[model samples]
Target: MDSGQEALTLLLLAPLFFICMVIEYRILKKRGYSDYSLKEVVCNFSLAGLHQAADLIATLLLMPFFLWLYQFRLLDFSLTPVTLIVLFILQDFFYYWFHRASHHIHWLWASHIAHHSSEKMNFTTAFRQSLTYPLSGMWLFWTPLMVIGFPPSAVVLIVALNLGFQFFVHTRIVKKLGWLENIFNTPSHHRVHHARNPEYIDKNFAGVLIIWDKWFGTFVEEKPSLVIDYGIPKQVNSWNPFVTTFHQWRTMLTLALSTKPTPFHIRLRYLFGSPKFADNAEKRGTTIK
Candidate 1:
């Protein structure tokens, strides 16, 4: 879809987003998960808006590349209804794996940590995207859709729609939808994804479907007794957009450069290991060596 069309769709979907948020908040209140303060919600969403603006600008600047890919044979030109549905599903499926990798891979985590840095779960949190994702190979994961004959327009539309669907999943309001929770990614499932608790960490990586998490062994049920602590263990407290995007990158680069003659394995681990691996090494009194 063109940028104008995408913007129109987002405008149309805005109401539905608010409706879902209200429904979710009511549910969370009923379930007693509504302990958060208004200030926390405002702060989180404000930072998220800044991040989204940066992302919007980046995506706009890169539209030419997307157009070129579409004009050539690299991306398909078909736009039948069936093709569109397939494209949407394919994009989401790839998103599931990409989201999972962002948690598992250290370098990717450096780019993704901004989203999880917020210690709150709300619809706005869903908008907390990484401005550095374009530089982090995130677009490469969706190339298969282009290769499989999805037009660039269709690809972009499906992506935006997929993201629109995910906005509802970020809230703490919706509890369970019976079997729906098992088949689809809901607020309940996403809460687990944002949790910092031991058992909740690195779980629930579905975008629109919960089946992906179930099939991949990353699914975890929400436990009321285990209070969900949102945000990374080492939080990035700054509201500055630039700081949020490059803070982890700076830290990782420092660690890598400071380790002289680093073995290939350690270098690879530094790039792909879990976020906590470095801290765990410190706790065990180990260094690169």
Candidate 2:
């Protein structure tokens, strides 16, 4: 499938997404759980709209380059059933690294933090995305697939499928599945992913398969005795879409561009290293928090 087909597929499934959100909202409210608030839901979808718009523009601009790069593919691949299955696994593997890097690298986190900004973990919470993802070089993660002889269209479709599968795992309604939780990324595993607890932070970066996390040693189980607090360590308290999207960008840029007497490498680390390093830099009064 090409970009047009990808968009069409998502458009057709749009109603299903809304239906699931409504069902989750009703169920949470009926159970007297405060997971679904009107304001947060609206903010989630608003950020989603901006994200979609930016993604569409980025896809158009970047698709040509991917197509041009496909000419010198290392291996030729036909879109057979077996190849599609292979593509799915490879795409998930790449997504896992992309997600892990987003957490560790301050540059990417400046965009990804918007998705984790919400304190609520309902179905609509999955809708929260950053419009700056394209700028943050998210599409770079899938370039390997394109260069390995998979059609750019096929890669796009597989990415869409991987992301669609992840949407269902954003809810708190579903408990841990039996053995499937060990293999697939379940709601329980995802809850741990979104949790702010020190043990949970930067864990469970699987997009479809949980095995990557296990093999890579980043997997952490959700503790029944522990309460999960959603949202980042530093919260973006504003509901304004611009503030929610660009707040981290402001912090990161200000820190990286500060005129302090620090070495150039430390300033570079502020832009490209972990948020922990950035926090330390801020604590030294090198930059505003």
Give one digit per residue, the lDDT tens place, for model 1 in 107-208: 888888888887878776776677677677776777677666676566667777887888888876567889898789988999999988989989999999
What RMSD does model 1 have? 3.2
Candidate 2 C-alpha lDDT tens digits along 15-58: 98989988987888899998877788788889988987887888
Collision pairs in model 2 = none
How many backbone collisions does model 1 have? 3
Position 237, candidate 2: lDDT: 91
lDDT of the structure predicted as candidate 1: 0.74
- Best-performing candidate as measured by TM-score: 2
